[model samples]
Target: MVSTTFEDLNNSKKKLITDALLNEFSHHTLSTAQVSRIVKESGIARGAFYKYFDNLTDAYNYLYHFALQDIHQTITTDYHKKFQPDDYVDQVREFTEKSTNSRYFELVKMHLLFNEAHFSTPVSNHLIIENEFYWATQVLIHDAIKQLMLDPSSKELILQKLANVLHRLAKEDD
Candidate 1:
């Protein structure tokens, strides 16, 4: 997480650093990311980067949180509503397929790749999802997205299966 100092920065200055972080993380995996590049691109001093975050991973995780917030803002689901299966499926497709080409997509891919190695994981980040039905749906959608990444031809089939799976979940509660 970024320090309050970062939060205190002027909006334009903050955007400069955020843009630099985005460009670096979106282009390189965590293993290859360098703070030197971020500082250079943002035109901030090397010491300033450390003042904002603990390290590269800290900054990367902060940006990940920021991106997830952005994703949630665009989500169309009203989970408390009468469980419209179509709405759920569309949300899945948007979060998965449509986001594959997003600027933050590569950074997300890197997180997916290295998520397990973070020894001191937060509760939400842990794999022990207590919501069984929600977990099941997410797992199915995530698997579908993984397959879509390998083969775009699976989109139609994936969409059908996504709807079927969500519909099943919705029906189960009735």
Candidate 2:
């Protein structure tokens, strides 16, 4: 979580810090990130970095969530309502296209490639045991995104494979 002091900063100052953090995290994993670099890039004192975040992880989480929100806004599907496999695929496609083209691309790629596994906290998997279909869909969608990141040229093929599996699962659920 960001500190109140960070939230209180003016828009320009906030952008400077956040943009600096984004650039740092995008190029390096959490373990390798340096506050010295962030402060230098943002033109802030080293002490100010501590004032804005509890630590490096907090800063990373803040930036990650901010990127998520920005990407989510580009999705056209209404997640609040129930959706079909096609709708889910459309959402995934939109997310892939938008994130790949956005400033957060490297940040997102680094998260998927390295940062997620390094974090001590595990991603929630209760849904796997509770709803197999939904869990499978989530897995397929995530893997597709991973594939896209690894081999962007295979986006269509990967998405098609995911769609095929999801469609089969949806049919079985009937």
Candidate 3:
């Protein structure tokens, strides 16, 4: 199989459309995401939107890559090197609070809430980064949990149920 290069991946018009689509889809449901609004926000002509993408769903799929890129960065760049279970909880809490200012936080939140078809096309740069981030987090947490099992002092109850805790915190505040 022939390999694709960065030049093949560069599409400025498509990226612009995808960026606009991410903002729109995050603010509204899939059914309600308006192409006109996306075009208007992107400052691109309506025809240009279709020229770059097949339709709204195509646009959304493209936008998913962008959101995944942002999330992958957040998970990897902000992750702690040393596992302090309580510190992990506090960091996630701080992230939850800081998410209000994150441009793509709504998209990330929506992704966690609803199940949908994942973006299928390979986004060469971000896809690999995301895979690495996901696997690294899983491995780190697994090791941490294992270590916690060995030492009572290393274990923190609050960290064990962080997912449930964050969900509850968001639900209560929203």
Question: Candidate 1 lDDT, tens digit per residue, 1-174?
Answer: 799999999999998999899889878777789999999999999999999999998998888788767766778644346657787777767776555766667666666665425634553354354466765765676677666655567777888988888889968867
Candidate lDDT scores, in order, read 0.75, 0.87, 0.55
Best by lDDT: 2
TM-scores, one per candidate: 0.77, 0.91, 0.48
Error (Å) of candidate 3 at residue 79 is: 18
lDDT at position 144, candidate 2:
91
Deviating ranges (above 4 Å) for candidate 2 = 76-83, 119-126
Encode model 2's per-residue lDDT on 1-174: one tens digit a residue: 799999999999999999999999999999999999999999999999999998899999999989989998867644335539888888888998989999999999999999987554333454446467777777788889988987899988888988899999989867
The residue-level lDDT of candidate 3 at 113 comes to: 48
The lDDT of model 1 is: 0.75
* Residue-wise C-alpha lDDT for candidate 3, range 89-159, written one tens digit per residue: 55444444344346766775665344243433333334356544444444444344344333436345535
Report the alpha-carbon TM-score of model 1 versus the true structure. 0.77
lDDT of prediction 2:
0.87
Clashing pairs in 1: none
Ranking of all predicted structures according to TM-score, beginning with the best and ending with the worst: 2, 1, 3
